[model samples]
Target: MTREGRWSEPYEIFPQASGLFSHPVLVRISSQEIWLFYRKQQVGESISKPYVAFSFNSGVHWLEHRLLPPGIEGTTRNPPYVDRIRNRVYIPSFSVYESPDQELIGDSWVEIYNFFSRSWEGRMGPILGGSRNQVPIEPAIVKLTSNKLALFFRNASVEESYICLSVSTNQGISWSKLKNLPWRSYDNSISVQSGRNGKLYLFANSAPAGERLTCFSSYNEGITWNHPKLIDSGYSIDPSTYLDRQECMHHVYTSKDAQGTQRIKYYRIKEDTLLLNCPACWILEDVQESTEE
Candidate 1:
C-alpha cells in the first residue's frame, strides 16, 4: 500500500508455507486496522481453506494468522461488505464439494461475521448450483438499499460463461433464484461496487478472455445495466474497487508483463466524474504501478 500513488517494493504478508496462497481480500475494520483474508490450499489437497491475518497499523504490519472455523470460507474472490451500523461483515463466499467418482460441484453463500464479537453469527445460504449447466462462485455483493442487497457471481459453466445475479431482502439471510445477466465473462472473477451517487458499477474481463477490462453501470439498483465500457487492456483480470473518503474510486487488478510476470496495476477516477459521464464513454486510464510478483 502507498500513500503517494507510487509502487512500493513487494513484500510477503505471510511466511512461506507448504501450500499455495491465492484470492486475497482485504477489509478495513478501522483507520488503523485491516483484516486480510485469503485461500490456502495445502500440497496434494483438492480443497482450499480460508485463513486470515490482521494488520493493526494500517497494513504496515500483519499479525495473527488464524484459520477460520470449519465451515466458513473467506471471501472467494471479492471483498466483504462491512455494515458498520450493525457491526457485522457480510462475506460473500462459496463451498466446493468434490467427489472421487463424480464431478466437482460449487455453490455460493453469504457468511455473516460480527466484528464486535469476532465470531460468525449467521449463515445465509448454500445457494445451490441448481443444475450442472451452471456453477456459481466468486460472489461480489453490494447494497441496493437499506434492506435490499445484490449478489453477483461468476457462472463457471463449461458450456456458457456469464455473470449471474441473486438478491436478498433481509440482510442476506435468504436469496432469490440465481439468474444470468446479459453480460458475458470469460474471466472467472468480478468486482462490484455501489457508487456514491446510487449507481452500481461492475468490473470484469471482457469475453474471449484476456482481451480487456470492462465496466458496466447499473442505474436501477442492478435490474438493468448499460453496455460495458473499456477500462484497460492487455491481459488484465480480477479488478476490484475501493472508494476512499474523498469519493475517489480506486481500481486495482492484475496484468501480465511482457515476460508473463504478474504485475498489479492501479487506476483512480473520481466517483462524481464517473457518474457524470455517459455510459458509452471511457473515463479511466492506467495511472501507476503498485506491485509485481
Candidate 2:
C-alpha cells in the first residue's frame, strides 16, 4: 500500500475494520481532526447508506455512526472524498432502483456534500455539471489556479473509460460544458490533487477492462502517461487518493482474501512519488474520538 517501510515497524490500521467499509474517504480538517466518510451496508440493499466517522489527535482512535437515513431505496456503496483545494468534503455513490421486495433498479443518484455549507446537492444540477446519461461513481475534483473547480469522472458510456473533465467556475454553482479528457480513468478513481505542479495524475487499472486490475499516474496531468505501474499484487479494484497525518500522501485500495473478506491497504507518498511496486504492507493508523455531525 505505502512506499516506505514504517521503519519496517509493521505500522498499519486494520483488523477492526473489515468488510464493514465502502467508499472510504478522509479529510484532515486540522492537525487535530480527521474527517472520515463511508457507507455502511444493509442486508439486501447496496446503496442509500452513508456513514460519517471522525478521528481526533491524529487517527489513533475512531468513532463512526450512521449518517444516512433509512428508506432511501438503494444500496450504499462507494466512499466519500475530501478536497483540500476548497476545504470541503463530497461523496458520490450509486443509488440503485428496486422493485417491490427490493428487486429492481431505482434512481441512481450522484450526490455532493459541502462541509462549509453543511448541504448536499445532486449531481444532476450544476454541482457536477456533466451531460452523461449516467455518471459512474468515484468523482475526482481539484481546484486549479484559475480558482475553478475541475471535476473528473469515469464515463460509464462506451466511448472510452477515460476520465471526463468539467469545470465549475462559481464554486460548483455552474459548470463548463463537458470536455473529453485524453486521460482515461478505469482502474482507479483518484488522480485529483491540490499541488503547485501543473501536471495531474490518475490511478486506474492497466490490465484489460472488466478483468479488474492495478494502474498508475501521468506526468502531463492527463495529457500523457508514462507507463502502466502496478500497485496491488493480487489485483486492485477501486482506489482513492489520501493524504495522511504526517503530511504523507497515499494511494489506498481495498484488498480481499480468498474468503471474500476485505482489508484496507494504502500506499504512502515518499519524496513526491508513490511506491506502488512494493509488497503492500502499509497500515492505516487513525486516532479515534467522537465528534458530532
Candidate 3:
C-alpha cells in the first residue's frame, strides 16, 4: 500500500517449492533495499524454521534464499524486530518438546542477525514460563540502552495469563531471570520501541476482561512501567507498532471484520499524544489515573 491509501495488486513474492513458506518478517536495510526472513514448514506438521531473502528494489524482485541458524519447532506470529542502533536483527521464536501423554512443552529462543556479515546467531531460553503447563512464546525485544537489552514475552496458558520481562546486559547472549509484570496480557503479542523522549513504549493486548490494545511507558528502562492506557478496542490482538524518525508511531494489528474474517489494521499516532496518554515512571500513583483518562 502507498501513502495515499492506494492498494497495489498482490503478487507472488517468494514461492516455496517443497513445503509451506509463511510468517515473513520485513526490515528496511537501506534507502532502496529491504530484507525478509520467513519460516518454512512442512504440510500438516508442527515444526518450522527460518529462511532469508532480500530485495534491492523494494520487494519487487527478491533474491538469495538461505536458512537462518537454529531454526526451531513451533511457529512465530510476530516476526523479528530490527534495532538500527545496534545493527542487529532479533527474532523471538520458540520450539516445543513433548512427553508420552502428549503434553507439549514450549521453550522460547532468540536469534540475532548481524547486518555487516549477513549471518545469524541463535540462543534458546528459559525466557519466561519454565514450569509445567506454563508456555512462554511470542517474545518482543528492544535495546533498552547502548548496553542493555530487554526481552518481554507472554506467559501463556488456557487459564490466567500475563506478560513477563527479562533483561540482558551483554546484547542478548544470555538473559537474566524472568520477572512477571503487573499488566495482563492474554494474547501473546507485545511490541517495544524507544521513543524520541528517551522512554521505552510498549504496545500490547491487556487481558483479564476485554481485548484491547494498551500502551505503557517506562522511563527506568523496563525496571517498572506506569499504569497502562487503552489505545483501541474491537477485538484487537498481536500488535506491532514502531516509532519513526519523524516522531510518528506506526502500528499494525490483527483484527476481525463483521463476517468473522481476520484482517490487518494500521494506525498512525503522534508522539505527543502517546506520551501524554501514557505517563512515565515519575508520575505519582494518585495522579496516574487523572493523566490517562
The numbered model that scores best in lDDT is 1
lDDT of all predictions: 0.75, 0.50, 0.67
Q: Cα deviation of 290 in candidate 2 (Å)?
A: 41
Question: For residue 266, what is the lDDT in candidate 1?
Answer: 86
User: What residue runs in model 1 are displaced by over 4 Å at the alpha carbon?
Assistant: 1-10, 15-19, 41-48, 98-104, 128-132, 145-147, 272-293
Q: Write the per-residue lDDT of candidate 3 for residues 62-84, one digit (tens) a residue.
A: 99877765544322444465677
Candidate 1's TM-score: 0.82
lDDT of 1: 0.75
Tens-digit lDDT string for candidate 1 (15-124): 66678888888888888989999888989999788999999999888889899877677775567888989999888777667668666677777888898888878777
Candidate number of the best TM-score? 1
Winner of 1 and 3 under lDDT: 1
Off by over 4 Å in 3: 1-9, 15-21, 40-49, 67-70, 73-88, 99-104, 120-134, 145-147, 157-160, 208-210, 277-293
TM-score of 3: 0.76
